[model samples]
Target chain A: MDICKRRLMKELSTAEKGLPSGLTLVSANDLTSWYIDITVDSNSLYQGQIYRLMFMYSPNYPMKVPNVQFVPDENRPIPIHPHIYANGHICLDILGDGWTPVQNTVSVCLSIQSMLAGNHTNERPPDNDSYVRSAPKYAQDSRFIYHDDSV
Target chain B: MPETETYHSETIYPVIASDIAMQGTKTIDSLNRLVDYSSLDYIDVPGHLLCPICQYPFVNPYTTKCGHTFCKECLIQALEPNVDLSVECRCPIDRRPLNRDYVEDIFPAPKIISNMVNDLVAYCPNKSRGCQFQDQRWLLQRHIKDVCDYALISCGGIKEDGSVCSQPTHRKFIMEERRIQRDYLLYGYSMLPPTNARLMYGSSNIHTKNNIKDSASSSESVETKDKSNSLKFDQPSKNNLHLNAIKDTKLYQKLASQDDMPLLELQEDIQIPCVHQESDCANGCGIKITKATKEAHNNIGCTKVMLSCEYCELQVAKPKLNLHFEQCPEMTISCSAKAYGCTWIGIRRDLEAEHQSKCHFIAMVPFLSKQDKKIELLEKENKSLRYHLDNISQSLANLPSFGNINRNDSVSSDSTTYSIETTESLGALPVLPVDLSMTNASISHMLMENDRLRADLDHLTTSLAELEMKQNTLFMQENFRNQEVMHSIKGMINTLRQQIHYILLEHRAFTTNSSNPVHIINQSSKVASTNPELLRRRLSDITRQDVKL
Candidate 1:
């Protein structure tokens, strides 16, 4: 990573309220690639589970949101939360439609933590079947409308 | 009604299935299925973190961005003391950014994978020191909060820690320490006891018992002191008294904090709204200002501004004179009429007349009194016109039927020509003649005397169907007029009901014993938004603080 991008990732990974889960940054086979899990000790639905997530950023870095996804679809697995897609796509506007470059991973993690915590309904998104198979990628298309926090 | 705990047995299935699906398809199907049901079953996690920087398990690992991590304690001691603000620690990647400390996700193994991968991992890094770690990541927070060996217990002094106190915990710690006394007490005081004596000297059991006793005594002392503090001023709240003594300080501390929630937050806390209007914004802004310093600013003169604004000839003054006048001008300030959205900014020399005539924001129509005058005029003209039209049409429609059957058989030819002319004149009016059915009952109700004809229609025809159709049409027109009158009457009633509901809701806010005051305030706020007089009257009565909710 360039000096500037790496600097932001450091403060964001360790700053106050940064990365709600105790998720640590772990490198894979390739030095450039990285992924890990966040154990959200939140009062949210995704509590008590370690959510494995991958963080992929283009060289563009801070100017664009990092590609963060709950890996292995573990704690926040898709076919579950109504507000979240089974394909690991989220319906939160702040994560996508309303995303501003100013937002950091800390804010993103906290938002997700709350998302998992407060969801009373345990059903998957209504369009899970269609979105999962036929439109598997649309959930992350960035073109999908994210009008509200709720689905 | 909310499901507190419904998905216990079946919850295992979803957790397992989701865990496998997230790992991607590279995972073996049989292994995935095996974990799909056995999710979240973990004896403990054996995370022997290996530091990327040291090429070994992290001694005191520190993380860095670009995923090229480090051993924290070693790096800190080796590098500059203050690494956070220093520019030395750069990310090992593209050299573009200096991501200082590397951080790792906690317990990366999902419960589904944890049960399997956990067996493959090394021993706990902290276990060699005799720390018997047997908890999973899920239980770690609870462990640290309730069972951590090093958890800091508050000293529970009366004043906050920021202020100096006559006493300190270190002194108390030394004097009241059971472990310390265990070494001293048995040697000095000769007090070893049998196992049955729970409070015997020098036992680990005695140490724990003493700690509990000390905790209980200190808490009771704190409670007794709190009671005297309140008894001098505040009355008892029964069970809520202790709750309040504990809670009020917390609330006060929260209020002292820089960014506490407004009244809406306290509404959640107290579960009630403050409704004393005397403490509200008497300035008529209808905004509730927090009770703070400078109470004098609350009396700023705003009455004149409200009136001037109404006329569109509003004046302005500096805020020091009256907060309302901060932007008001000597000349009439132009405020766009709130109707037809005339957002024009103009000088108000003749603004009142200009508004009365041209202000689109203000409705062109005037007050209810003026509206009543106009409506009354329209109603009178409509009623008379309706009666005249009804009379003419009814006479013509029933004329044929009302004519005698014997006379029709022998009527003269000139009379028939004369009758045709009369029917043509009557056709101009929008009314139906009386029916034959009415004539059968009584001729008086069926007939109308004409200007030129000596005989009335009822005196002539008594059995024509065409006359009946015209009569019914005339009757319908009369009913239409009646409907308008009834509608105006109903409108007045609705306006009255709305005004009363508004006054009652507003009046209840300032008064005490408002068991349902929040409900009242909510309702009044909603209604007041739509009603100008209700809003204005309420704004005058309620203090600004009352409007915070």
Candidate 2:
């Protein structure tokens, strides 16, 4: 019990220290889960866009990577483009095949914003629905598949 | 719980437990306006006379008790039940103790039947629902009592029960207010009542009740004005007429009457130009400036001031006139505040900035760094376009030189074979001696060199992808951390709310106590604990950091 408390306390204090700018931590109405809205420099395609990424820490976090989902909703107030689905589901590999324990909600959002700033293909997968539901369900150090770099 | 203010029954409560404050001359007559006086139905008090001997409603109209056939209270008093009474009880039959336990303790009649065709209550007052009243006030007393729910009372601001109406009822009253409005409507000015004259609604409340003891006891009578079902006051005029409703004798027709202010005594406090030398006095607040002063205002330096209130009319005044406004109650009111398009009239004491902060037309907070962002986006798009154009141009240039070899059949045929050959053979071409053949040397070098370059490019692309993949994973973990902190803060707030609830419960006991500074201090601290600003700021910072990440 003490260990869990200490770990969460440390995470909270760190989040407090980093929030001077626009970093926000949105906990589920219940304390069971939380998500962060990864914002990019508004100058980019992802600017003014808030890419929501959820972090599901196990009753044991950090020791293992928390389960994460880049809950992109195109229906959100954020502007839509080719790369982002209307559902806000991001096609970035880091949230999928490139999943790793070391990754966190902030890094994933930054990666997506950067990913958007550098790519041009706006189309979703031919089977976008299936892809979202059936992509590798867990982060297990899958080999990363990076394709486009040109913005 | 507050008393229902049922129009029939009254409940008195003491708010200031210490020395009373000015005896609060407010006599609020909350008549149930939703009541259909047109239908004329009720089972409340003052609806009937009681028998003097039995203290129940009068029956058989016998003059036996003191030879007076009044309600029981009258005859009971005549009996000199108490030692102070001067009258004696004389039974009509014998003049004994009047003790006829012979059915004496019971209701006298088996039934009463007047056919009530002319009486008002055969149908339920809740005419919307169809329950017949079956009897009069005394018989239906237990049934029509507030708990039974057939009672229909409503305020203009509230629905059928003084709560905001979810459904609307379209009904209006023909009140004295309508008559007074007729005066203003016809004359363009509200004439003051004659000295020693009373407003009209007073008489309406006095005699409007059908048949009851409303005047059964009082010797003195006062009258003159007001509507039976509705009361009226001049709509923000300089002239005023007052209303007075004597309590205990009668009640107003509806509960909506409670919201109207009884300015009979303090009418001047709200209506007269007691400020600014009364030079500006006219139909408007405080007073109006003279024509010369108007010229001065239109040309001379002036400070713009605005005052607004939900319940008052708008007024505009000058700051130079501040000295004259010190004693003016309406100074706190509108000061020519036309900018807001508000026509509220009130004193500065009540019209604070609270009204302005909530104005719907106020502008929203601007987007942060909007210009810098637009510039940054333009620059980034420019850079990407430049790189893309350069890439296409480089490919175009490569096609042209290769075009030369393709047009020359000798090289074209050989290149065609180069593309189709087995992978092992394509790069295994012999290195021709430089002195032996120029075309052959060029072809061999170009093919082998092309293979090596393709291999190197593949490796670099693969590495770049890995780096991007890592960046995304890191972002997901960071989001998880922030969520944890928000929950902790919310939990703290809920705990504080519970504590405050307990403190409030405890306060009800001490609100009656005269001395208890400690409770006040405790309440203040408990209130302070619930401030969400700290949590809000904390949330702001975390969101910002998440963006940077």
Candidate 3:
């Protein structure tokens, strides 16, 4: 198996045993992509809402940044935030230019969980309509200028 | 001896085989990335065997000062400053500080960890390629490369460069006679037609085909007698067909009486050439291994396989090295402004991000002063040109007769004419040019001469201005020097005045205080040519006479 698959297999097996509260692995059959379901553990705007996070790993995973977005499916809804767009594109730096290789699926999921837990605003990004309409298919493809990091 | 023999074979054989099998089935973990060893049976492994970073069995385990153990590679990666671009080094587990100064002090694999890792049974990494061999975890690489029939081997021909040819096309095969013997003993004897025919009739053909083996097996009958006797340790069943075929042969009955030996003993007798023994032995490490494990020794365990970094000259193991440029501190790298035409080359260590951050040409702002100098020169030229234009316009209005002159003569004159002087003397200058026109047939010729002189005067005045500026600076320097000299002279005059005033005072004291004792002592020194006491008495007598007077 490639390094990505081998590492994913390990991550999957570890997640199979148990994960942090409110964070659960939904589907990880594909080596290149995975879906993780996260529920805000604390009382917040997105407390009970189910949000699915889709991670598309490049061939050079752990070294290159992976494409992460809030994938709104039939059962899952996108988490409202100033940095997150309606099209599921996130302006968070870690998912963009500020990514560190040491970050893995667990860390990324937790970062997203904390991002949702800290949000008080129930709105999309300021330029949500224009950005989503012109956003690339992959979040990594867009040159996102991450200015605010509070949320 | 007979009673002990039964117990040994019955008890030890199964236990030894299973022990080897248990070891063979163990998985060899990779150090390149994180691996989950939790898939393994929890009861069979110790928690300490797992590396904290990869969560897999440690390969080259290391311990930090904090007592946290990790794979050597994982620790190195964690400690790399470029990984997170953070200046502070810290342990991944406890977030404790792991400064670079103490990173080298991290302990090597402990004795217990080394022993356990070496003892673990591991399947060949090439098991997917149909290798069935399993051995000690450390020996799997060799078994796969040297002994496994499925493992590809080099063509072994010498290249023109005197290096071994690296074409991995040849598959190692045991001798046909030996293969037959091994198959018969291990898999129950069977009478295959090819085997019977090769032994009975084709044996002569085999001897002629392989000249190297012809001497070893001189005759087919003699070869079968020796091979069958040595291979008869395993008792064949009554239903065996190969026994029926070879039993009637004369050598078969002679082999049946031979004593039995263990299969492992026979297998142990197989000697495989240490692939790099010839190359490595010249460097003083002459190691000969079994044919099954020679590949692993040369590939993994051989210290002779170290390669020097092209840039830094640091020795690195051949298999573990990636692109050295990424890690070599002394690698030569071009300046970050190479795209902007900077051609500096330096070691990676000396040129930090600061080098690019502070690069002058990259910023393109420092060179603006040079451009400013050029602009100043252009403005000076523009000022002179404006003065010349004003003179030309004023002259054109004054001399209406000058307009009819040939343009060719005016173009032939030098362009550097200083109109400043000529413009001031325009009244007299026009009269001279008009007189020259009367004498010359081409009136433009006189105008050209006048223009050339004016051009020379303009150039001369420009040079004169530069000289004047240099002279001004020189004059200022001399003036400063004179002022310093005058100040020192005034100080000397004051000192001379003070000395003259002191001398006058002393002279007055000698006149006014002649009777005084200290003045008499002074007079005695002046009169030292005479007797000293007499001079003092004479001076006192003179003072008394002067007082009487």
Maximum-lDDT candidate: 3
Runs in model 2 lying further than 4 Å from the true structure? A2-5, A20-22, A28-31, A42-44, A72-103, A126-151, B1-549
Candidate 2 lDDT over B336-406, as tens digits, reads 34343555556655555454455332222123246557767667656544433443333333332332333
Worst 10 residues of 3 chain B by lDDT: B9-18
Candidate 1 lands at a TM-score of: 0.20
Fnat value of model 1? 0.00
lDDT by residue for model 3 (A1-151), tens: 3334555666778888998988888887666788889898584677657889998888766545688998988548888888888988888877765664456788888888888888888888889999988989987888877778577
lDDT of each: 0.40, 0.39, 0.55
Docking class of 1: incorrect
Q: B-chain TM-score, every candidate?
A: 0.18, 0.16, 0.26
Q: How well does candidate 3 reproduce the true complex, by DockQ? A: 0.01
Candidate 2 local Cα displacement, residue A55, angstroms:
1.8
Indicate which candidate wins on TM-score: 3
Q: Name the lDDT of candidate 1.
A: 0.40
Candidate 3 docking class: incorrect
TM-score of chain B of 3: 0.26
Model 1 lDDT per residue over B247-322, tens place? 3344434544634233222321221111111232434455544222113334453332233433334544324344
Q: Comparing 1 and 3 by TM-score, which wins?
A: 3
Candidate scoring better on TM-score of 1 and 2? 1
